[model samples]
Every structure is written in structure tokens, then in C-alpha cells.
Target chain A: MSKEKISSQEIIDLLSAQTDFTKRQSEDFLKAMFGIIEERLIAGETVKIKNLGTFKSQWNESRKSVNVQTGEEFVIPGFRKISFTPDSELKNLVNEPYAHLEAVVLDSNHEVTEVDDEDTEELEPLNILTEQALEIKGLLSEIQGIPLTKDESKIEAEATVEIEENNTAEIPLESIIQIDPSTENLFDKIQEKMHQKSEELSSLEVVEITKDESEIENSIIEIDDNIEPELIVAANNEESKIEAEEEIKINEEIKIQENDQTETKSNYTAPEISTSSNVYEEEKIENHYTENIIENNDKDEITSIASDVNRVSEANNLIDNSLDPVDYKIKRKSKWWLILIIILLAIILGLIATYFLSSATRCWVKYELFSDENKEKTANVKNNILNIFGLGDPEIAPKPAKIEQDSVAIQAVAEDSIKVDSIPVTQSKDTIVDVFNRPRVYDEFIGTEKFGQGNTLTNISKKYYGHKDFWVYIYEANKDKIKNPDNISVGTSIRIPKIDPRLIDLGNPICLKKAKELHDLYIEKK
Target chain B: MNHKELISAISSKLSISKNEVEQMLDTTISICTDQLKEGITIGFQSFGNFEVRKKEERLSVHPATQIRTLIPPKLVVNFKQSNVLKDKLNEI
Candidate 1:
């Protein structure tokens, strides 16, 4: 057998020794510790006991079980079990001693011993009072097999017969005492005495057997065989002794009566001590006989005991099923580490999949912005496109990828004064080009005007160009001298630009048409 | 809303004139700018933190144009909202 387990009482004693508390106080402290932990679990809160483990509880589904003794099937529905997850430090501490041992593995072909079915019985007791009731039932069953008669004469005659049979079969006759109300009181007294005597004799026998089995073989046989006859004879003797004591009392009463005939009364008292000792010996013999029968026919007896065990198990199951629902709750704790690991793996796989899938197919423009030549060429093309679309100012439209690089490229193009194709060059009426001769510089100066008081650029433009819109050109050329074009001095000079900013890109393609016409005429003449 | 609307709303809520609120706001902006110019960290409790972080100079190539350039080192303002404010907004 394994080492005996420490009970709660032992823990209380140890706690009391360690602290300045009485045994009761230590016991209360232990109880409070468990109570708090249980409350936390019931509230679905995890309680972590430092250096030990965490305790958690959850509901579990119902399950089925079987009675090991009678092989009776039943359900042991759902119940709570407070579970623990040991701290890593504690785990390492426990495993330190056995760390060097490797795991044991066996070949599949190797045979292993199986556990005994009866030894695997689940042992759970009901309420304390209920258990006491069960014990009383067993006692009553033992008493039912006895016959207790108060009449000493009849009991003695039966005892003599039992003694005679004991001499022949060597079996005690206690089993023959059929239960009867008339003798139940006498039997109860006899049984109590016999219980004490049997206990003493059994302990003595155990010691004797352990010391020298061969030396006490005869005594063991005497105990195993004569139990029934001894029980019958003990009961008979007990009754006889009671009658003799009553006779003695009667004699005393008669003497007293003779002295006072007018007030004649009788008293009878039985001396219970002497009879109890004798009955005790007799019952011990009976116990011995039953033990012998069990030893000799163990296999057959076990089979016969099935019905009794079945009844007991059925009662237990009924009580358990009726009350366990409210009292029992199955608990389970979730392992967050397992869930965390799974989530991490899923994220990693998703990121890998996304990276590969996105990179598999993609499209984007690859612009060039390195060389000065490439910059101007691309800028001119971009400006031409922007001009045709009549978009906003080229300086702000079509944002460059790199600001400094684009600025430098535009600066180089400006300094070189490159001649680029314009979108629409609409010159004013005085500056139209001639087609019969080579193209020449159109103008050095278009016009000039003087500003006057209360003369805004719009009003001045209205006087010179017959429109208010061309005042922008007058303002652009004299922007250095004009603080506010609308607030010009009375005799201020304002120069007009030779190249109209609008005409720079607003001219029609009349020269191209005429040149094409001349080429066709020349070809026809040829 | 916008800058003007925020100023007017603050003015109404605080029972102050619009010009006073706007001037005070402008002063606050200038103060913050001055502090940032000296590379100081400013924090508004239960709101956010404004700090200047130094970015080291590095050579980077533009992917589209393959134009490589050397960027200069500079300081940038970093703002981090306090958890108190974040939670308040999340409640909505």
C-alpha cells in the first residue's frame, strides 16, 4: 500500500504549531482559505495561488458510470471539479529530482497487467446521518438472523441441542437464532457483549498469526468452526443467568414478605455483567465460523453477495441523482496559451499569403527625372499638353515627384531660352506675320501709356486698348513701379509689353495653310 | 468646423469677444511655434503630447524615376493622443 494520506485534522495541527493560533483557529483559517477560493471559482474568476497554481472552474456535461461491486449501470450527471494549473516554478521544482530519468517506452507486443475492476470503485459517501443509517441497516440485517428468547428453560434446551451439533459438525449455531420480539431485548444485550469480546479475540488472533502461524493453527480452526454453536449456547446461558438472578431476588423478596404479610410485594433484579461476558465469548465463536466459511468459499460467496451490493448501490444512485444537481457543478479552465499560439500562427500565415498574392501582379508608371536634357524635353511636352487642355498655370499643375529636381530642371530650361512649339499664338491686329517672305521679329514695343490720378489700370486699358481686360499686360510690365495699379500717380509712366502674354500661345495656323497651298501650286506648274 | 468657426465657438463658450479669442489663439500659436523652434517638447494633460524628433539624413531613391538624392537631417513634430482622450472618443 502507498503511504497514508494526511488528513485535514493533521493540517490543522501543523498550522496551529506554526502560528500563534489554537487548533480551532487554525482549522477556521484553513476553512476560510478554501471558502474564498471556492467563492472565486463559483463567480467564474480565476484565483492564482502564488508559487502553487491557478484555480478555475467551468460547467461540464453529464457522464455515465457503473457500480463496481454489482456491475450496475447508472449516470453520475454533471458536476464541478476545481482544476489547477501548476506554476512553472513549482513544476520545475517537482520534476528536478527525476529530471535525469528518460521517458519509458515499451514495445506494442509487450503484455501489461490490467487493473482489477472491483478495486476501481468510486468511493463517495452521502450525508453523515445517511451513512450512519446505512450502518444501522447492516446491523439490523445481522440481528435478523438471530433468535432471541427470554425464557431460560426453552433457551437452555435449544443451547444443549446446538452444543451437541457443534461437537459433531464443529460449526457454531448462532446463525440459528431467529429474530423474535420476545427475545429481541435479550438478544440485543447479548450482541453488545459479544461485539466487544469478538474485537478483543480478533486482535489477539491477528497478533498470534503474525508471530507464529503454525503454533496458532488449532486456535484459528476453533474460532473458524465453533462460532454458530457458541452463539446459541451463549444466548441460552445468558437467559439462564437472568432467571437465576431473578430467583435469588424472589427469595429475598419472600423473606421480606414473611416479615410483613399485610404488605406483600416482590422485586426481581438480574445481574447483567456475568451473563454479558459469557455471551461475548459465544458471539466471538460465531464470528469465527462465518469468517471460516467466507475464507473457504470466497468465490461462491462473492457471487451470492451481488444482490445485496446491487440494492445498496441502487439506493446510493437514487440519493445521488436526486440531490447532486444542485450540489455539483463541473468546472473547466480555458488554456489561453493554446489559443494565443493558434492566433499567432494564423496571422503569420495570412501575412505571408498577402505578400505573395499582392506581389504576383502589379502595374505602375516609371518616370525619368535624371538628366537636364530629359527634364526640359519632358517639361516642354508637359506644358504643351497642359496648354492645349487649357488647364491651370504650368508652375502649379502636374506636381513633380521630386520638388527640388523639377525646380532645377525648369530653371535650366528657362536659362537656355529654348524655342518650343506653342499651342495657339493669337497676335493682336498690328502683329500678324507675313507669308510671302521669311519670318522676322514682329515687334520691339507694342505701346506705352501714362498713369493718371483716379486712373486704374482697367480705366487706362479702356482708354488705350479699348477694353478693360488688357490692363493686366500694362500692370505686368510696370509691376516694379506700381504699388497698387488702381492707385497710380497722376503722371506715372506704364510700359506695355511687346509680346502679349495671351498672344504668345493664341495664334492661328494661317502660314502653314498658305505654304501648303503654294507647294501644291508649284507642283502643278512643274 | 474651420479656423474661424472654432475661434468664434470658443469665444461664445468662454463668454469672450471674437477679437479677444482670435488674438489669444494667435498668441498661443506663436508661442508654440517659438517653443518648437528651440526643440522643446510640450504636453497637454488628458489630451496629447507634442514633441520634436530628429530625423537622420539618408540617401533615398525614387522608385518611379530612379532618381537618387541625399535628404538633409531635420526635426519633425510628433503628436500622440493621451489614452484618456482616446477612450472618451471611442465611447461615441
Candidate 2:
């Protein structure tokens, strides 16, 4: 396991051991196999080996590029590359360890909620409480006047009724205590002062009730022309007592007509009064009740009224508590919306600024590129930009042509110099004709060889001429022995002619140009 | 060349029977496959290296429907050509 890399030699050794072949035989087989695969791939044929993989050659298209430092544009010539795709069995075998693993389909909404659970947990309870408060507020508004609709009101009504009944029973004893000598005389003046305020409130209430009676009389007179005075007296007695009792009863059955005066006044003024007003009302009611005890004037009425006021104040306090969080939440939501809007506005402004800045820079660059004075430099820059963007340009089309012409001109100059220098050598070897039908001299033979299986003229040429392109010269030397240079039979005897130093010179560009020309000529002739 | 031609060529080059060459090739391939299954890199000098590579799991979305699909991770056989082979191929 520690030795991760298995070399080709090891594979050959393994093959020899497993197949009962010699090491040399396995080695030669492996070489021939790989060589044939390579040959087929180079010939643009796909080689598919059973239980292994398919090897194919892919041609990459030529692309344009620019040098980073020099900013010079150039084209990268395309070449073929070998690509191998493994067989399905091999793929499955390699993936055997992870074969059991599978892909799972995930619900987007479920995943999102799971990710947000931490943040939502902190916020959820507050949201639930607020929702509950809103529901309670709606229920309270619907049953605001009905006391039994609220749990606290139901219990308080029962307690108040019991207390009121006990006070009625104890009225005589309370009056006797009021008549006691020492404490009665001392409380006399405070009792009178408190009685004055109660008298005024009661007087105002009587006036409002009388006005309500007048409206009722007008409505009754319209219905029946003659209304009896006895009936009016009965209405007043029942109205006053019922108004007092309805506030204490805290029930839904309270007659709307009888309770209208007091209920309307309480509804109009209750919510406007703050907690301080509530304390003042409590103090005033307590003093008024003490006065009622001293005077012994309908003590039960005073007790019931006091209890009703206390109940109203408690209801108001409950409402205030419920409403405060709602108001706070509204204000918090408004603040968040304002902050979000401000942030959006800032981002929009920043984006606008950046857009303008980029446009300005682009305009400046365009102006510099299009200006007449920098035409030549701009052309070069334009070419570099086009190369960078992989765009073709008409101006760049002539650049390679000019380079080729210059190369041809240089080769012509070199050929002229070579002709002038090789006059004596050409005159000595007048019998030998070159591929171009011109007399060319060669040095004495370096060697003689027989072309065998797997032997190519290019390989032979590389051995002697140091380049595969010089194979044209080998073909020219073996023209009489060979028919087609592309197809040579095995065991063909071929001569390896020693070329003149100037003709096959590696440093001279003319040698390569001449060899290329000869190659094109021979191919055209074939 | 195909399997038959490759086997015949190897047999002729090594002067062995085609059956022997085919057996030797099958053994070589089986051994290489076994070694690769064990996660070893089989390197051939002046040719290429064959090894197992792990492809990571990924999420792919359909362009039109926008349906997300999870691609499970798997081990795959990979081949990387040596620089010598690359240079030889580019020589053409």
C-alpha cells in the first residue's frame, strides 16, 4: 500500500508472471501495443481496447492571444491531443467503495426554515404574544359594557353583590355608630365638606336624567296625546334606581333606555382620564361614602356606585396595559421601514455614482483610442484589444502576410549568397540533379541502410539530418529505389547520402526553406 | 487499430502466437484494473499515468424548470498523459 506508483516495468513483469511469458517477450509486446495505439491516434483514428478505455485525438482550434508584458498580439497554432475515456466496467470498479452513496432531494422551504430556526426562535414568542393581545383587544371592544363577558368582571360582580347585600343588612348598626358622641362631633365638618361635592355631582346627574325623561315624554306625547303625571313619577323612580343598579349589575341585560344617561357619560369620559384621574375619583368616592354613612342616606347606593367606579378603573388599567405593546410594536415597525428605505436609497445613489464614474472612464478611453494623432499607437492597441477579446480584425489580416514576405526576402538573399559561395562545389558535381532540376553537390556517402518494418524516412532523416523536414533530401537520394515516398516497402535498400554543410546547415534558414520547397514539389508531383 | 489487429501486430512484432499475445494483454489489463481498484497509480514511461480520482458531489439546476438536482460523489478512472507523450503528439 505504501508504494502508490506502479511503473510500466512492474506491469510488464506482472504480465510475464501471469501469462507465463518471458520478461523480454512481455516487454516487446507492451512496446508494440503502445506504439500501435500511438500510431493509430496520430493517424486520427480512435482505438478502443476491450475492458480498458477508448483513446481518441481531439483537434484544438487556433486561438489569438496577447503578450502581457509586451502587449504584442500573436496566434497560437492548433494541435491534436490524445484523450482517453475509461470503460464502464473500469469506472464502476473504481467507484465500488462509494457505490452505496445516493443523492437526496431537498425541499427548499424546509431547508430555509431549518437554517433560520435560530433567529426565528428569538422572534417567535414576541410575535405570538402580540397576536394574542390583538385578539383579546377585539373581544374586549365587542363586549366592553357587558361585565360577565370578562372573567375578572364576573368574579368582581359576585363579590360586590354580596358586599352590597351585607351593607343593607348592617345599615341600622352603621347609623347607630354614626350617632356615637365623640367621633361623630369630630367628623361633622369634614362630612359636610365632602357632602357638598357629592351633592353637586348628584345634582348634575339628576339634571341629565330629567333631560332624558323630557325626551321620553316628547316621544310618548307624540304616540299618545295625553300622558299621565303618575306614570311620569313611576318612570323617574324606576329610572334613577335602575341607572344606579345597572352599573353595579355588570350584566348584558341592563336596559339601554334606563342606563343611557350614565353609560353615555362614562363612555365619553373614561378613556380620556389617566391613572391620576382614577386615584382622584377613588378618593372622592371614598369621602362621599363616609359622608353617606354619617348622614345615613341610601348607604347601599353609595357602596354600589363606589364598587362600579372601581371596576371601571380596573378595566381601564387592563386596556392600557394591553394597548401599550401594540403601540410600541407599530412604532418599531415604522422605524424599521424608514431605516430600510434609507439604506435602499443610499445603495441606489452609490450605484448611480459608480455607473457615472465607469461611463466617464470609458468615454475617456474611447476618445484616446479614436483620436487622430495617436492613430498608429491606437492601431496597435486596438489589435492588442482585439486579440485579448478573441475578435478578428481586418487590419491584423495583413500582418502575417508581411512577415512571410520578409522571410521570403531574407531567404532569397541567403540563396543568392549560397550560390555565389558554392560555385566551385557545384562545378565539381555536375552530374547530380536536385529535386528542383538544378545541379547540386553532395558530400561522400555517410552510410548505406535497408529500410525495415516500423522504419520511416522521417526517422532516418532525423538520424542524419537532425530534422524530420529534411526527409525530402532522403527521398531525393532514394528516388530511383523508391516509388512513392509516402509508402515504402519493408526491406527496401536505401542510401544515406552525406549532404553538403551549407545545404543542410541547421543555423541557415535557406536550408529549411529549400527543403520545404522540395517537400511541396514532391507532394504535388505525387 | 482494433483489438484483433493490435493483438496480431504485437504477435508479429514479438514473434509469438496471437493467442499468447492476447492472453498476455488480457492479463496486463486485468492486473492494471486490479491495481487501479486498489487506488494505485499505474505510470507508463513516455506514455501516460492511469489512476482513480474522486469527483465531488454537486448541485445542478435545470435551466428551464429551475429544479435542483444533487449529483452524488463517485470515484472515476482518470488518465493524465506524460510530458514526453504530449511533446511527441505536438510534434505533428
Best by DockQ: 2
Tens-place lDDT digits, model 1, residues A362-430: 210111244453455455445444433334252433222332232233223222111100100110110
TM for every model, in the order presented, reads: 0.17, 0.33
What is the TM-score (0 to 1) of chain A in model 2? Answer: 0.22
Q: How well is candidate 1 docked (DockQ)?
A: 0.01
Residue pairs in clash, model 2: none
Candidate 1's docking class is incorrect
Q: At residue B57, give the lDDT of candidate 2.
A: 65
Q: Which stretches of candidate 1 lie over 4 Å from their true place?
A: A64-76, A102-526, B1-92
> Can you tell me the CAPRI class of model 2?
acceptable
A319 Cα displacement, candidate 1 (Å): 99
The stretch of ten residues in a row with the least summed lDDT in candidate 2 chain A is: A419-428
Error of 2 at A350 (Å): 65
After superposing candidate 2 on the true structure, give the runs of residues whose Cα lies further than 4 Å from its correct spot. A1-3, A64-76, A109-526
Alpha-carbon deviation at A96 in model 2, angstroms: 1.1
